[model samples]
Target: MFKKRSLWISILVVTLIIACSTSSSSVPKLRDKHHQPFSSESIWNMPIGADAQYSGAGLGQAKRFSPEINYYIVTQETDPQVPWYFPQNWGVGRCELGGRQLGKIHVRADLIVPDATENKTPNNAAAFLAPDGETLIQLNPLTRCEKGGPVFGHPTPREENIYGMGITGGQGGSGLSSIGGTIRLGELLPSAPPIPHVLKLLVYAHQYLYREPPGYRWPAVRSDAYAYKDDSPLRYGGSNPKLVMGALLAIPPEMREDDLGLQTLPGKKLFHALQDYGGYIVDDTAWDNYAIALESGAETEFELTYGYSFGKNSGPFYEDINQLFRALSIVDNNTPETLGGGGTPRQPLAPPIGN
Candidate 1:
């Protein structure tokens, strides 16, 4: 009787396990409200009509455009005059005004090119402008040739110095790349200064060559390619200033958990500042890349030259930033404060041999 009872119990346990597994399997998968099934190729081949839209309360109005109208520019050198690829005005609504109530904005992008531009191919064409006068940012090609050739008007040569704040590394990597590229208008804008809402915007331009259905195959021009000419008004330094300004505005500030005024209390101030306004998206690969850059010292180099210019930081700020990372658990290993460092050293080192 004892053995029979034990066997029944085991069978019952097995039955329960099977029932639970079946029930769980029968349940449907859950997706985010904005979740869309997309492969790199499918997204690349989608037409302008399929592109996403952006609008919000604070933004003036909702706007829509063909995906082809989105532009990204890549350059070999840093050119202030050249317009960095960023969406200006598509679907931005006015939400808020002061302090932390600045309001929210929405942005979307499609992968396919619209049929309208198929027949009327313009020479030296870069990107299409929205009928409402919104400029589509373009990705410049990086090549060694002069004008009129296949590579004419492409991005700067690989050897040229490149600079940008967010996405410093090339695509599929971290930060921005040495080669220039376009940023979707929605992805460019900073989040509301004080709000905690998380926004995810799609960039339609990068879909050009990667998406399917009408995906461009290998040996085809890179979807990110563009023309580069020294004297051309379209050059990075010579592109439309308004567009450049728009691109700058589109870059979202880093997200922070505390109010901006509270940032002055010290301890992780710089790290929080970076998280709040430096365009690092929390929980995303870009954020990890930024942390890696800081740890590897690339950010230090970047900071020394352009840190202050961007209003981000100065010398020794990395240590403070690292501390912030530690507090947030973004990084491991706490660096002890020491003499010549921000915090006092636990103990003094022995006197120098020469001294």
Candidate 2:
């Protein structure tokens, strides 16, 4: 009888051990490899590419078909010189309406001057003048300025398409540029927008341009129109107008991948802007960097299908832009315990496969 009892006890012990092992194994262990939580300071200070490795000044030109129009990224210093009639300033600074400070604005110039200048004989010029006689410049200022604080001139009713603010996390719709959230600029910074995704794209293109060892050259002018332009003023109109504008920063290829939660087609389109246009802006500063970062954050929601669906690894992306600033200290330690803590407990295991 004792021997029988011993056998039964052995069986029970084995079963208990197995149960414990199985339970432990079933527990989910969340792992995030892309962006291990780091203190905000560390991430913010994280070296963005090699430092002054990429630094310069002056307006970078973009080619255009129109002779009167000119496209370029003007640095902050040079921005003031741009004609008042110009649509907008592409670099940093507060936008003023009628001499009052409106909200902060980012100007992306599409048409610098219109083709109508070609037909002008100096006699019909009076017809083109506004009631005030200011020559109507075709340049359209796609301004992204603040609302409510200091009511700037109402954006033209048709200019309301706020699309392409870059990685605004699904807040905007159908070509609208108004980002849903506001990100403060300056030392005491608020959360960043989803603009960095665009920056990432620009960075990627910059990398591509100088990929080879020094001395290797890629075609400086790819478009045929600009390549064959003659000195004649009329032929100047045929110049590749596209060269006049490039992104202030390009998006990195890796950023477009599913990991960052921006795999959708729209996300891809935004990413293209980043890749193509990154760093085209003349001025490079902390404020611009921060703006880019915040813009990227705002765009995240948009990329995720109005925040309903997200890429599998997008949690970190969200955290990087949204919570990183607040959780800076935690990120330094590079552990969940240091950051926001680990994920919640997993659900209890279901009954065996068949029950």
Candidate 3:
């Protein structure tokens, strides 16, 4: 009787597991909305579109491009530009104005101002996504008046939509949100899905940063320019007109990932992503290295759980990534109309924006 009962219980558990998986499988998933938060039509979410054009101008230049571009360390104590995610409890706070206590706004619940403020730095950046699935809240430099009281920071004056143009939210000289375009948890892991969105890129802006008169592209309203060659001070500065802000850099579709000989799992993942969706040059690294934005707190979680460090010299991981960046070229036609450079899309267009 004991043997029979145990076998029956095991069968019941297995049955429950199968039933759960089958039921949730058909749920209408709007592609990458889980890892990358935004509408399907947002530039970051959509893959390369039809008749794509390439900006061979920058990679064609000497100083701005590098084979050994540095990887961003989100686990670092400062300047990672990560965010603390809060659950769906919309709490109204008095100090939502960075400790003034007069302004009130609905923020992610239980946002202990002190805890958020303690991790401050020059780019003391953090992000909050309201449950509305549309608005993105910026906590550029969160501050508090009390231990766990209402909190606030230098949030943006312009309302930011998660599904809107991912420009101008955080402290970056570029008006991009600290949260958008960042690699979220599990994205680089071995068992993860292929990244369906553009990854964010930061490059050393010394002589490489360039802009046209009036500055930057449409999606990018303005920029912290190194110079505009048309009237630049530094001789030979801004040599690459294609290095303008909002440049969509990617591995040319002709370069197949299989031929790249990438060794690390993460590197292979990155190669496919760059090939399919590519990454956007969203901000300046402020130094002579390139960095990709990863969500805050995600690196620690990945390391502890998977025992892999996202830092430099992680064997073939960095090597694989460097190879991809070295081959990155700009999409000169990635305008609002030709979103991903009008051409046969590298990947299927994300499901059209809907309910």
Candidate 4:
């Protein structure tokens, strides 16, 4: 009867929803140079409402960004010329991050390791999607003396499932993924589309170390508790009370690139994406620089193809990056419930989730 039909309709609708949620790109996402981390519904991929609540303290005004450096992102597929390994188990060495103990883990898939030259950065962090396509494997202090052999690094305390909420990951004092929010390979090229997801940010968590009142927010497991080195000052510790680890820094949806007077194409692209998707505070620079993490070789490709360098203080990236940071307002109300806020989204929901 009519009731039966209605019930069937409801069941059908539910099935469709599940299908949408589980359908992943059939193409091997990681083998390619494209793909962003996390699932369709991931907070990193969601756009905030135009009216999302924010704090009045702008990052630029606070001088929170360190203009000196932009961190690089190392990923599984970064260097195809180099060999890759699928180790049976990941090694742990007093590993700890994002308030979780990397020392304890029960992962089932092979740990994806790269044989490329070990990244020279101190963080030496690298992330790759496990073969299962469900787990995001992170390697901090990833190392390999020989280019084609055994791999070594600590597995994260809490490995994120891309199909799930993806609220947390394996690295950072903030419990964020070294790869999540990192600017993907071609995102900044002149021919590329506007960035489509939240970017990872590193603040100058320096000697003047301070965090938000409660330390961190959802998605972030904790904050930078390392108040200061064993020397110097900072007996009376405190928080910024304005910014936190998990907080999103975004352009109010109502604002346009024109409002910020962004002139460079690169800046305009970054501006639009940042306004729509915002960015996450993933780590601390420990120095005087605010940085956005980028995929390996991303900078090199950009320089060779785009004909500019971030090193130049007068370049478009330097100008726009500084300008955008200054205009950013903390998405203070961003939380599990209000992640995208209440206003209309700038982009469609990310592609449906699935392995």
**Residues forming the 10-long window of minimal summed lDDT in candidate 2:** 121-130
> For residues 191-302, could you state the per-residue lDDT of candidate 2 as single tens digits?
3223221121111112112212121111111211221234522221212122121212223323433444453443443343333223221111111111122222233443
Model 1 clash tally? 66
TM-score of each: 0.20, 0.20, 0.69, 0.70
Misplaced by over 4 Å in model 4 are 1-34, 61-120, 207-214, 228-239, 353-355
RMSD of 2: 21.3
Which number leads on TM-score? Answer: 4
lDDT of 4 by residue, 60-97 (tens): 42233332122223233333323333333223321222
User: Which ten-residue region of model 1 has the weakest summed lDDT?
Assistant: 330-339
User: Over 4 Å off in model 1, which ranges?
Assistant: 1-272, 275-321, 324-355
Task: Give the lDDT ranking, best first.
Answer: 4, 3, 2, 1
> What lDDT tens digits, residue by residue, belong to model 3 across residues 1-355?
9999999999999999999998889665554444555666677776876577776634322222222111111121222232232212113332333333334444433334432223222243455555565666664444443533454455565666656665556644466666666778777666777877787776655556553444356566567644344453431245676776667888887887777778876777778888788887766655445667776556675567556566554456566666777788888789877777876787875664443
RMSD of each: 22.9, 21.3, 9.3, 11.0
lDDT leader: 4
Q: What is the lDDT of candidate 3?
A: 0.59
Task: Pick the winner on lDDT between candidates 1 and 2.
Answer: 2
* Residue 212, model 2, lDDT: 21
Model 1 lDDT vs. the true structure? 0.23
Write candidate 1's Cα lDDT for 1-355 as tens digits.
9999999999999999999999999875542111111121121111111111211111111122111121223222222222122222112211111213111111122212211232322111122212222222222211112122121122211221111111222222111222122222222123312211111111222211122222212111122222123353322222221111111111112334342223322223233322322111111111111121121122233335433311143333333333333232111111111101112221222111120
